[model samples]
Target: MDSYYFDEKSKFDARDPLGILYKITFRLIQIKVIKMALIFTFFVHLIMNCLHFFEILSTFDADLLVKYGPTLFPLVYGLATIIFDLMFEKKTAIVLEETFSQMWSLDSTGSKTAKKIKKESKILIGLVVIDTILATVAIMFYLPIMEWDIDIYYAIRLFEMKFSPTMSLVFSILYYATIPVLFFSMLCTTFALFYIMSYEKFQTYAINDLLKNISIDYQKIDDWKMMRDQSYQNTMYKRLTICIQRHQLLKRMEVNINQIIFTPI
Candidate 1:
């Protein structure tokens, strides 16, 4: 399971929940220069793409538009999403920390439940690995894995001066360099989705475990007389209240997270 801790100086810190993903996406927000540089890099890439695009946009046929629109749209959307996330990175971190702390506070209840959550954590982490591998594999299409890298075409008309064949090749290499970072920009959206979705998954697992334990404990009461006892009633009430409070906490977390991510709650 991923761990988090509150530092005296910092509100919260991930113990590599998604392998520096939190660091890259959220922690970097505190470093204004680095965050601005990331945005600036994407902006430069977008501008170059736009210029190159409009240059031949008049000559664009259905085939050209069909090929270009898919790529262009995602770039714009991904950048917008990343920017929005950075804007709310602090709130996101705080909510996430509070969620984790609350959940972990209940860790003493059941060893069985803890074991189950541990197993689930592995699966979720594996999913993240699979996604990262697939994202990296996607770079093969843009990088020079083949003689005709699509990014070579993207970098070709980036400047007003007509590039010699050799210069175009050089520009393409430079463009290829930017693809990892830009593609990472795109993947940040995916990472955000994964993190939010995983929270809900863990919430389900934890709540089910708690409720199941409550059921088993209730069934184990060998004395019907105990049910009528005031002390026993108070104990049961406390357990029921705990269950209700757990559900309410998770629900609020869900809504707050959705609001921050602009997801429909």
Candidate 2:
């Protein structure tokens, strides 16, 4: 690999503001805090179901639990998988980062194509952040209000036990707080998944663009053959060789992406 692809001055360097932000976001999603929050959410549901099963909590509908509980499984599972990948697939992650860096470093310094890719990347990240914010708002505010209107709490029955006022307040606070934590974790994980998939697709497009450019170069070389200059032919052969290497590299990148990221997702 060329040193320029890994250059610290590159826009994709982790020290840059956007890169730092991306690293922090990825780290946050992979942390134990999100996992614990998800587990707590699951346990809350499980406890409610168990209480209803054992007749300890009255007014709990088993059918409602059955309907809502399974829906959360995908969220929990997806978050867990993302966490596992970040933790255990260090090599793959490094390759992904390098690939991103190389893509950003393409063309000469301050190239229009590089600027466009950077702009598109920023737009995608902005959209994902907006989606996460909107999802957080919907889950934290809208869903609860909707559920309250429907009296679905009677179905889950978290606070059915008669307790001391202090204990009741504590349980109420914990229960309400856990809802947002669980929801935020799930939303962030989902956004991360979408981001990864978008990035990989963008990479595929970039590779195709490079292949097209190489094809065009080959056509130009064919046109140059009318001049019949030996030196020009030698230079064309070298360019063709470089193009072939680039094609192979792209193929390897595609394979790595499928094996390391897409398959796992």
The CA lDDT of each predicted structure is: 0.60, 0.52
Off by over 4 Å in 2: 1-21, 30-95, 98-112, 142-150, 154-156, 162-165, 212-265
Quantify how close model 1 is to the true structure by its C-alpha RMSD in Å.
5.8
Scored by lDDT, the top model is 1
Angstrom error at residue 34, model 2? 5.2
Quick one: best TM-score, which candidate? 1
* lDDT of model 1 at position 253: 83
Q: Write one digit per residue (lDDT tens) for candidate 1, span 20-65.
A: 5555555665677656656666776777667756756776645545
TM-score of 1: 0.71
Which parts of model 1 are misplaced by more than 4 Å?
1-34, 52-67, 105-109, 144-152, 160-174, 215-223, 263-265
- How many pairs of residues collide in each model? 0, 0
For candidate 2, which ten residues in a row score worst on lDDT? 1-10
Residue 151 lDDT in model 1?
A: 31
